[model samples]
Target: MNKEYTVTDDEVGTRLDVFLSNQPDNPSRSSIQKMITDGAVSVNGQTKRANYKLRLSDNIVMTYQPLQEIEVQPENIPLDILYEDKDIIVINKARGMMVHPATGVYTGTLVNALLYHCHGELSGINGKIRPGIVHRLDKDTSGVMVVAKNDFAHNSLAEQIGSKTAIKEYVALVHGNITEEKGIINANIGRHPVDRKKMAVVTSGGKSATTVFHVLERFKNCTYVKCRLLTGRTHQIRVHMAYIGHPLIGDPKYCNSKNKFNIEGQALHSLNLTLNHPRTNQQMTFTAPIPQDMQNLLNYFRQTI
Candidate 1:
């Protein structure tokens, strides 16, 4: 189906791709750009680049092609469930586990396990692929996460996180010894202009992000620190830590190859999470013990230091 939109006066000067992404249809910018380049999108009856500037009253037409949804199946994967109730379930997500299914990854995700455990009672607000998922932990970052069982609970929990009322804390071992006892990184984050796959501390056209860290222990060349996120931007902690020159140990994406530790992934863990109960409105906190790999690395550091 082809859809048409007239650029409003207020929408003038916006990039063609940006305007399309902000629409209610919510297509990803990459998809929109791809469509534009393929001539699936046209402005003023002519094909335009994704970065073409829009003007008032410009007529834009887009071809709307729905993506084929992949079916997610239930899997009997074991879960370290911390807490469960009528409305929510909290889990200590393991490392190397994805929170939800993506293209080319349909099984062995947290969602697949939730589907089996919840028995189709999980909330569908996030659609089929992310049923009951309220928040996410990166695949390599093991930690605590809460899932909503119903729509009401999902809305409540999402509100708490979006409003910054929910608190999330992490423990990480970084490459360099942090000199400061405690510090805050207040920077704007955006997709890296050169490497679109990575996030960076951007100076312009970025969203505000803040992370506070306190040094827990310092080794000869590494520091164990606790970090609290004030904003939930993608890779916020990793980007902020790397920006400050103390990338997390074993962080393959952000850190250089100078890491001496033979670890599979970043030495970061979601140590604690605090939020209000959706049903009772009572404050609740959950903590997950550090994974064995991180602990072993820490022990090695201790012996060496």
Candidate 2:
């Protein structure tokens, strides 16, 4: 079944996925991407990228059948909001919280908390079933993330992210003593040839990604590095760091057998995020303190061998 909706002024300047969340049945951003790839979604009769910015009065048409069971329940998960306004909210996502509802992760996700806090304010870019997800960080990576509250804000944020205007920075505890103070890792990142579940640094048949990193401190064996994302690819930082013989500490999937710290997951933290206000045209930056786990890892490296 297909339906058409008129974009109101509020919907203007928001991403299509962000806009869809405000509707009656919210479909998730991932589901919306599939619909877009399958030609089941259109804006003003034109097929556009998932990050397309919607304008006022733009006609949006979507074709999909509602799922028999919708499981996006509101959970009273704790949220650490660093910034919030009418358009968007920047959250300092803690480790152990999934970005959204996914397989094996139906509860205690950021989406659930957003639903609880925002209530009916989230825009439905995918559908009314899922709300307010623009971009995502890994489950184990704690950092700042932005959620769109309305369609206009969602679209505007989408444009900024798509154009690479969104400034994102991460602090990571990586294995190996990096000698360089600053360097850029320009490589092609793609799915691992043998491992479908992991990403790798490939020389061909992949997207070109550039990651600029600065050495913040050097431990006995590990290095504290600040990474600036030039191109946001899946597992870009981890893969690039690993490519240069400095895989993230505690990254079980990619790290070597002999690791100094026995942390739970990869030691990566999103420390900073800067983007333009969807409605205000003002630049905004959100800073997040390093999580306890990461800070402890650094402390361990500092104190012991």
Considering every candidate listed, which one attains the maximal TM-score?
Answer: 1
Q: Going through the candidates in order, what is the number of backbone clashes in each? A: 0, 24
lDDT of 2 at 158: 86
Candidate 2 per-residue lDDT, tens place, 1-305, comes to 67898887756788876666445444556766777878888988998887889888888899875442456888788899999988899999998778877532466888889999988689788554458888889877899999999888889888888898999999999987999999999999988875546788887898999999999999888899999999989988989999999999888668875655556778999999999899988998999999887888888878876
lDDT of 1 by residue, 1-305 (tens): 77789999888999999888666544557768878888999999999999999999999999864424577899999999999999999999999998987533568999999999999799999898888988998889998999999999999999999998999999999988889999999999988865555789988988999999999999988999999999999998999999999999999779985667767788899999999999899999999999999999889989998
How far off is residue 27 in model 2, in Å? 19
Stretches > 4 Å off in candidate 1: 1-68
Highest-lDDT candidate: 1
lDDT agreement of model 1 with the native = 0.89
RMSD of each: 7.2, 13.5
